[model samples]
Every structure is written in structure tokens, then in C-alpha cells.
Target: MTPEIVEISFKGNKRVPYFNPKEIKVKPGDWVIVEAEKGIDLGQVNKVGRLVALFEIKGDPKNIIRRAVDEDLAKLKENRKEEALAFTVAREKIKKHNLNMKLVDVEYQFDRN
Candidate 1:
């Protein structure tokens, strides 16, 4: 049977379950956009199968908006560069203020929010 829900993995290894409400066919390793709290977000398909048994969803499972296209992929690449720059800047600022904390990764929302 086609899986009603699939697992999507984002940066930092964050994973969430989303349903193909529009019946969009997706497979593992395919990048996809999904509904998010603020707006749409992007992630890669990590697993495809019944997931309700595995995940304790806090609310309704978000829908898979669509598979990522070439343009979306290009934008994601740009987002990564921006995120890295932001990370470096933050680390420098932390060091400048003599803050005793490690600045690890910086993530930019897919929409650059």
C-alpha cells in the first residue's frame, strides 16, 4: 500500500512526519516542500511508510506541498551559503563580546525568514 505518511529530514537531522494529502508521490532522498508554522519549508524525504506508529505527532500531520524543483534546489543552495555566513558572523560576534558559549550552526528558513 502507498504510505499515507512519510518522514522528512531537515538540517540538523530534525525529522518530522507529513502526509501526502494531495497524493503527491514522493520517495526517499527526494527534496520536498511542506506546510510549516510560519510558511512553507523544505526537507528531504528520509523514510516512506506508515509513520503514525513511530511518531507521536503533537498535532495534525502537515501536508506535503510538493516536490522540490530545480529552482527550489538552487534557492536551497543559496540558503546554505547564507546560513554559513550567518554562522561565522555570529561566532565572531560571540568572541568579540568574550561570551562563553559555543556558536554552532545557523539555519535560515527556506523563505529566508
Candidate 2:
């Protein structure tokens, strides 16, 4: 049997391939939580199809962690709000400390460790 694969982009256009172990139905632009290198992460499905041969795959194939739920999206929004607040506070602290430094944009990580 041909193995199915899906392309999931973690950020921007950085798409990675994974094996669809269960073949849970999914479509492009679907928000899916995937097993990323740094634990589980949320990503968008870019493409879905089957590969010619199993050996044609590279590295270890990861399965979709699960389709994102309402709770997951809510948590993601809340985390984003908190991240913005933290960035603002960090900038303020730098000013208060009389430090001459310019702060840039902030990126939220998957595991945030």
C-alpha cells in the first residue's frame, strides 16, 4: 500500500513532511496540531497526498497530533495577548533601567523553554 503524506508549515513557508498514520481526513489551510521537533505545535496543512514508495521519505515521519479544537485556538489567542503584554513590559523595564537598547519583534515558540 502507498503511504500517505502531508505537508505542514510551522511558520511562514517552512513546510515539513509527515506520514499520515491514521489518515485522519484533513485539507489545506486546516489548522492542525502536529508533532514538531520541539514537542507538539500548531500548523497549517499545505498539501496532502501519497508518496510513491515508503523509502522515498526522509527522516522519521511524524503524525498529526490532532485537529486543533476550540479550546486550543482560544489558548493560542490568549497566549498571544500575554506575549504582547510581556513585550511591552520588557521594553518599559529597559527604559526604566536607563539601558540604551532597541527592542525588536518577539516570536512565540512552541515549547517556549
Candidate 3:
């Protein structure tokens, strides 16, 4: 299937990257990989349509890529599970090591490439 290359912006300040059509071939309900500042981000496609306009991109358009595939989705899910376990391990490690920093939150971004 052919995915469409699209621009993804975050926090109204940073533009993650461009996504090729091959990367976003899945339907609207499918989970796709969006380029993010930190890494590849996972998000469901909210809309899809034909390209109508082109504008000057802030960063290089070549940096943008595509959506995630089944393998990618699986890896992402596995990573999330691992991330949760890592958080627990980290908390325990912090307690054992007597670190001063407080664990407030944990965030994970997948498919950042």
C-alpha cells in the first residue's frame, strides 16, 4: 500500500518530520508512526486525503518518514510493556541507591525514525 508523506508538528513549536505515503498506508483508524522531537511517536490516523497544497517547510522535508507497520506496532507494544517494567525497576533502583530526584512521570515515544 502507498502511504502519504505528511508533516507533523508538535507543541506548536517543533515539527517532528515528514512522513512518506508508504509510511502511512493504513486506513484512518490504523495506528501510525508520527515523527516526534524525542523519537518516533505512535498515534492513530485521524484523517487522510489527497494532497492539495504544498508550503515551505521549516526543517528539511526529507527528514519526515512514514507510519508504523505490524512489526513496528508489535515492537512498540513490547517496548511499552518493557518501559513499564523499567519504570518499576528504576524506582526500586532509585530507592536502593538513595537518589534524590523524585519520579514524577514516565514518557515513551516510539517509531521516532
- Top TM-score prediction, candidate number: 1
Q: Is candidate 1 or candidate 2 better by lDDT?
A: 1
Q: Tell me model 3's lDDT, rounded to 2 decimals.
A: 0.55
lDDT of 1: 0.86
- Encode model 1's per-residue lDDT on 52-97: one tens digit a residue: 4466767777889999999998999999999889998999999999
> Order of candidates by TM-score, top first?
1, 2, 3
TM-score each candidate.
Answer: 0.88, 0.67, 0.51
Q: Candidate 3, which segments miss by more than 4 Å at Cα? A: 1-28, 46-64, 111-113
Which residues of candidate 1, in runs, are more than 4 Å off? 1-3, 51-55
Indicate the residue-level lDDT of 16 in model 1: 88
Q: Score candidate 2 by lDDT.
A: 0.74
Q: Model 3: per-residue lDDT, tens digit, 31-92?
A: 55555566657665443445312444465443335555798878777767877787898899
Rank all candidate structures by their lDDT, best first, as comma-separated numbers: 1, 2, 3
Q: Indicate the worst ten consecutive residues by lDDT in candidate 1.
A: 49-58
Candidate topping lDDT: 1
Candidate number that wins on TM-score, 2 or 3: 2
* Tens-digit lDDT string for candidate 2 (26-50): 8888878777667777777888885
Task: Kindly state the number of residue pairs that clash in model 2.
Answer: 0
